[model samples]
Target: MNEYFIDTNIFMYAAGKPHEFKEPCVSLLSRIQSGELKAAIDTEVFLEILYRYHHINLPDKGADLAWSMMDLGLNVLPVTKKDIEISLYFYQQYQDRGVLPRDIIHAATMVQNGLETIVSVDKHFDIIEEVKRIAPSDLI
Candidate 1:
């Protein structure tokens, strides 16, 4: 079984009802649940998911979904001082290249957690070579 650091967007698309991407989300999530893949997320991604959901008027449900992910053994990788420093360095390095703050956090979190792959639809994950970026379709 492979371990993956799940991005915020995947969780958002998975839990949001009436989403057109539901099936792919379900399939990927099932992989995580069955231990065919282990999914991990840090506070940065969690906060992103929460904000995105809340912006869409699903604040309460977003919080609930976060807990549900925890229940499913999707480990919550915490942020640390070293992670913050790493993120800062990444931010400085890529700031001129137009990398956003959130992406830097995600990249740093993935590296700090020792995660090898990131399950994401976001292309920014490709910027960091420390981790392999796996699209949702790649999971198939």
Candidate 2:
């Protein structure tokens, strides 16, 4: 099974509507269910998902969804001192290069783990070379 780190947008798309990528999103979830693909999610992605979902007024349900993903076997990457240090380094290095804190954390998580694929719809990953970004549409 190939392991992939999930970015927050994939979850949002799977949960929210615009419904353009519904099939692909469902396929990704199904892959996780069958254990063909190992899905990794970091604390930063978790916080972003909660914040964005609540920001859109889905407070109670957003939290419920977050917990559900965890229960569904999404591996939560533990935050370590090294992860923080790398994040800080990226914050300074990419500050003028237009990097967001959350993105830096995500990229750094991939770097630390030697993972190269990210399941995300966010284009910020395009700026990072450490991972290959796979969006929900690709799965569809």
Cα displacement (Å) at residue 18, model 2: 3.2
CA lDDT, every prediction? 0.80, 0.80
Candidate 2 ranges with C-alpha deviation above 4 Å: none
Candidate 1 global TM-score:
0.87
lDDT of model number 1: 0.80
- Find the 10 residues in a row with the least total lDDT in model 2: 17-26
Off by over 4 Å in 1: 17-20
Q: What is the lDDT, from 0 to 100, of the residue 59 in candidate 1?
A: 88
My TM-score estimates for the predictions, one after another, are 0.87, 0.89
TM-score winner: 2
Which lDDT value does model 2 have at 62? Answer: 84
